[model samples]
Target: MKKKLLVFTGSPRRDSNSAILAVEAARAARKAGASVEVINLSRLRVNPCRACDRCRDRGPGQCVQKDDMKKIYPRLQQAEAIILAHPVYWFTINAQTKLFIDRWYAFGADEYRCFKDKKVGLILTYADQDVFSSGGVNALRAYQDIFSYLGAEISGMVYATSAGPGQVKKNKTALKEAYNLGRELVS
Candidate 1:
């Protein structure tokens, strides 16, 4: 059976640099015989987690929020790997991606058992010269910690510096790395 992979684009801007890179990654994954789905978070009406603790009582992947996340919960459970692609905002992950991650608390009932052994990939874009100056390192660290706590296996991470919209398309190396990341995760 083909590996299932989900790519979530978190940029609020359409055709953003990060989204472009994610597209390339998804293409490569599809070529590698993995089934890929790309979801644009900006277009979805995913509400912030209310921390009501209802999901704990309800069970894993069960959130009280009656929004787009309700649909995503099932997809998340089915996917073998997930890639989070986003541009740095305010020295860290943007609000859209952060909100999505926060809602993962519903899986806490099982201590994130579903994430154990699952593959994870990260793609980050920033405007500054490098990761340190752009604070991409902070976002990377956050992902590291988050996935670690969930017992997920981090397949790879691809990041780049793109100052403007769609600038990442010009970054050949990052694009290649993103493609390789996708293939590697499925392998």
Candidate 2:
């Protein structure tokens, strides 16, 4: 059977640093024999969750929202690995990414179990290169907590720290890390 990866990018602009790395990672995963699907959040019309918990009531792991995510939900269920590619904002994930995560609960209580043992990877871009910055490590930790709650195994976190969108391309160390992270999906 062919393996598959679902990559989600929360960057609001096209070809942002995070999106660039995400595309590269997807390409690497494809070369590694995994089919890839990339979701650009900017193109979606999803909204934040209203804390309705309708998914729990559905008793079958279905999101109540009837928008664009309805289509992606099934893809997410079938993915062997999920990748969150995003840029840092306010020392954490952008509001768009966080909103997506929050709505994930609409699937089902046990629906989250599908993530069990499945691999997850994170690609983060930020303006601060300082590892100790409130935005750097904290963002990773926050995501770790969220993914863990859903039983997803975070295999790796690839972060690009620089001042500009394309600056990551020139950062050999970060690029190597991103490639290695992509390689992990196959291993």
Best by TM-score: 1
lDDT of 2 by residue, 70-112 (tens): 8887888889998898888888888888888877777557757
Ten-residue stretch with the least lDDT total in model 2: 57-66
Error of 2 at 34 (Å): 0.5
Q: TM-score of model 1 relative to the true fold?
A: 0.98
Model 1 lDDT tens row, 81-174: 9999999999999999999999999999978888888999999999999999999999999998999999998889999999878888888999
CA lDDT of every candidate: 0.93, 0.80
Candidate 2 whole-model C-alpha lDDT, 0 to 1 = 0.80
lDDT of 1: 0.93
